[model samples]
Target: MTKITHFWAFFTFVAFSLGLSNCRTVKNGLDEKIYNG
Candidate 1:
């Protein structure tokens, strides 16, 4: 039970980090296009 809980927590953390990185990349792309346009 404890191991499963730990795995779930780790998965959630990884997913959250990936989502944040994706958002940052999208924002950077938009900024680049706006500035370059």
Candidate 2:
């Protein structure tokens, strides 16, 4: 049970990171100066 919990946490983190990356790219594209000025 503990191992399963750890695995789920890791999976969730990875998914969250991926989602964030996608959003960041879209945001930068919309306002490149704000993010990469």
Candidate 3:
């Protein structure tokens, strides 16, 4: 039970980290285009 809980927490952290990374890149891309153009 303890191992399962640990795995779940790690999985959740990775999932949210990937999502935030993706969102940040997308946001930066739009910001660059808007201000540089």
* Residue-pair clashes, model 3: 0
lDDT of 1 by residue, 1-37 (tens): 9999999999999999999999999999999999999
Ranking by TM-score: 1, 3, 2
Off by over 4 Å in 2: 32-37
User: How many Å off is the CA of 6 in candidate 2?
Assistant: 0.4
Better of 1 and 2 by lDDT: 1
CA shift at 18, candidate 2, in angstroms?
0.6
The lDDT for every candidate, in the order shown, is 1.00, 0.94, 1.00
Better of 1 and 3 by TM-score: 1
How many collisions per candidate? Answer: 0, 0, 0
Error of 2 at 9 (Å): 0.3
Instruction: In angstroms, give how far residue 29 of model 1 lies from its true place.
Output: 0.2
